[model samples]
Target: MLTTRLPTKVEPYRLASSGKCLEGVIPLADMPRVVEAIGVQESDVRISLTFDIDSQRRSFIEGSISFEASLLCQRCLRPTEPEPLSSDFRLGLVTSDALAAQLPGEYEPVVVENEQLDLLSVIEDEVLLVLPQVVYHEEADCAVSRDQLASGVEPEASDAPAVNPFSVLRTLKDKH
Candidate 1:
């Protein structure tokens, strides 16, 4: 468990140089952005990070985040837990895109704004990346019956055929 309230921010460069490792749980309630995105859920997300100076002498951070999120199923209009969301990432601290571009593809570029790396923002971004864009249960598993979904009862095709005004134009062309 992390300290009472997880750290809201950290200085990545300094931490990496010092080679500090942090493993903790961030209560769902402590993450406003995550809460705002996923709405309220039952459990806390686990956060683990290790900071070190890479071979290239750059400060880098690597970590994994895991948590369960419940999203409303579009088909049933009920909440469903799709899967336990978890992901691992590597970040290279950089202040500019030029520096970011130099980093290997394996590491994501984390821009340091005034030397501070926002911990919450990073975690929220990782979680959102793994979340489904459109949440829905499998058709077979949906609580809403298939018939209910397909019940798109389009008004019975109107009994009368529509008259095309082009018919009059064709008649006028023929008369001409």
Candidate 2:
């Protein structure tokens, strides 16, 4: 396991040729983009990646990343830990959308810029894509309930009588 900052840019051709593997922990603070999206960053992200060339001779990398993150449950407005965040991906490099579209569905398209890949951004994108679209705590765990009503000891009478619109319509119909 390599315990160091991964190269900011990687030459896919040379890396895939060697079929190298790297394992390391990316500090949570280093992933500022992910922290902004998730709203909380605490644990270091464990990353393991392997470089390879697929059968079609396309340079690609496969890897898994996992971490523990805290998220606020929208319903409860309190913190909750999501299931351990982990994901596996195989990103195939392409310089153009047309080439990316031609790739097999199993391989995610990664458009390379200037023939280099930004490894940190790739990891952050993967994590962001897998996040839950909506957050909710278990019903029993929630502090707020839909049935709860405001404290009311008595009902105050209104100065004016309430009128039903439907009754007025009914009177008009009867008169006609």
Query: Per-residue lDDT of 1-176 in model 1, one digit per residue for the tens?
Result: 24634587998888898898888777766667777877887777788989899887988889998888888898888888646888899988899989999998889998998989888888777877877788888887889987776756677777798899799899899997
Off by over 4 Å in 2: 148-176
Q: Worst lDDT window (10 residues) for model 1? A: 1-10
Model 2, 49-149: lDDT tens digits are 89899888898889998887777888777878656878999988888999999999889999988878888888888778767777877778878775553
lDDT of 1 at 121: 84
Q: What value does the lDDT take at residue 118 in candidate 1?
A: 89
List per-prediction Cα lDDT, in the order shown: 0.82, 0.80
Model 1 misplaced stretches (Cα beyond 4 Å): 1-5, 138-141, 151-176
Model 2 / residue 154 / CA error / Å: 22
lDDT of 2 at 62: 93
